[model samples]
Target: MPLHSLNHFKSVFIYDIFIQPADQNYLTARFLRVIGMHQDFFWHAQQTLEKLFKAGLVLNGVSVKSKSHELTKLLPIYEETLGSDAFNSFDKPKKLKAELWSDTSVKDFVTKISALGSADARYGLVGYQSSKDDLFKLDQLVFKLRQRTMGLDWVIGEDFRAEENLQHFNGKTYREFIEQNPTEQIRHLSIPYQELKSIGENTQDLFHAWNFEFQRKSSDIDKIAPGAIAPELAFSLSRIDALLQNIEAFDGFDKEFVPEGFKWLLDNVKVSSHWKKMIETYLSESKK
Candidate 1:
């Protein structure tokens, strides 16, 4: 019900729901570029990251300028609000972890992604193209930010389900709080419970699509050679397999809701031989 809680919720939802999916779409486009799909990656990524950066600023109580897309410029605002120590504590993407943390590297990373927001990248104002490395860094940076914002509502003692004051934190109470606040930002944060529910449901849908649809449809897959597919897709499949393994061990969500392929993937993961076998089968079948 508090402002911090609202900010945390907005930041997390924007990053996890909107931004994360856009990032995955960007990644998927890299391997499955057909027409304007690559542009989808660039534009959506720039827009999402810009909003995410602004949300981060709002979360930290830093003033956000209206409609800014230059994420590198926001770094100073973050530093001023949260302090350099807090910013430094952030765990960057794993690939960049070994490198010594520097303001320059951070700025460079942000700037490169921000450049995608330029008219050239968005509308082909001039000759411009995004590289694979650029896309990869954008993916990693967004992932880290998404993870950072994930449990913030709980941290701020604003989780409606966990907080003792259920009546005060309920929808009616939150609506009343927004009315009292009378800020454009507060007014805009009127998130329906169903909308929140749909975010989780949509993620479940993605899992189902990947497991049942993408993996099930033999023609949907592209075989690079006799027994190998694109490395990006294989890595993604392995990651999904690992995700299912973790879920099975952790037992957080309803196992009944998990698709059959997720279970099968985990079983295959245990066998270790199944990955190679499946690829071989795919290749042989494709030949046929």
Candidate 2:
């Protein structure tokens, strides 16, 4: 099945774009409010929950209701139908009712958030605009939802079986295939890429580490002489070069912000001791 049509993928994507940013300290509460997209955070979060609940039902072969805004209503029905154990299947939202004024359950906390988006935010109600303090709490809550939703699709045994089959075909999972193939990976990883943009210095290290892991998993490296180019190093260098080339082609990037070292490093790929010394020195300097 195409990834977009999957309910779990849909929910995760919404959470990634809308809720993930809420956790970044760089995005201040005041900035979020003035940015005019605070309401979207709530709206997208609610939609994410709605899709998650529906996916759980559909995967279990239960008929989902046509459309429902009341998450409190949906929760009881889904729990009753699937049994409480299903809640245990994913990373369940942590219990924090004692922290709330009205002694709300974790389930109740989710329902209130759902209401914020489905009714209040959508209609521009007076209380729809969350206060700065409220945004902080909301951000924490959304962060939990985003993390918990990650493992939700694996609740059913069928997804595991299908994944095994997928791995068998190409020795890679659906996600692995997408990661190795960046055009499609961009559709998903863009959110994370944007979030991490604040940390400029480590950008190349992050790419190198991530690409090295992928290459390690899917490619074999043969041992060679000490000064000879190791297959792994050669492959990783090419991957890093490809990434830097793409970054350079990005329109309107300040030339100063683009790592000049990356281009220089790409131009000087070699297996000599001097090349290794250069890399070690460059890495040490990067840390400083």
Candidate with best TM-score: 1
187: Cα error in model 1, Å = 22
Off by over 4 Å in 1: 1-40, 65-67, 85-104, 150-288
TM-score (all chains, Cα) for each model? 0.40, 0.36
| Residue range 1-288, candidate 1, lDDT tens digits | 221333333443344434455445444444333333566566656665665555555544444534255766766665565443223333344566444333335566667656756667768664446553554555556544433332222332343232443345354433343334322122122221222322223443433332434463433233222222123344323433343345446333333423433333233223246754653454454446
Worst 10 residues of 2 by lDDT: 184-193
Residue-wise C-alpha lDDT for candidate 2, range 103-179, written one tens digit per residue: 33557556666777676567787356453334445444433333333323243222232343244434233334333
Off by over 4 Å in 2: 1-37, 65-67, 88-103, 129-192, 195-288
What's the number of clashes in each of the models?
A: 0, 0
Q: What is the RMSD, in Å, between candidate 2 and the native fold over all Cα?
A: 21.5
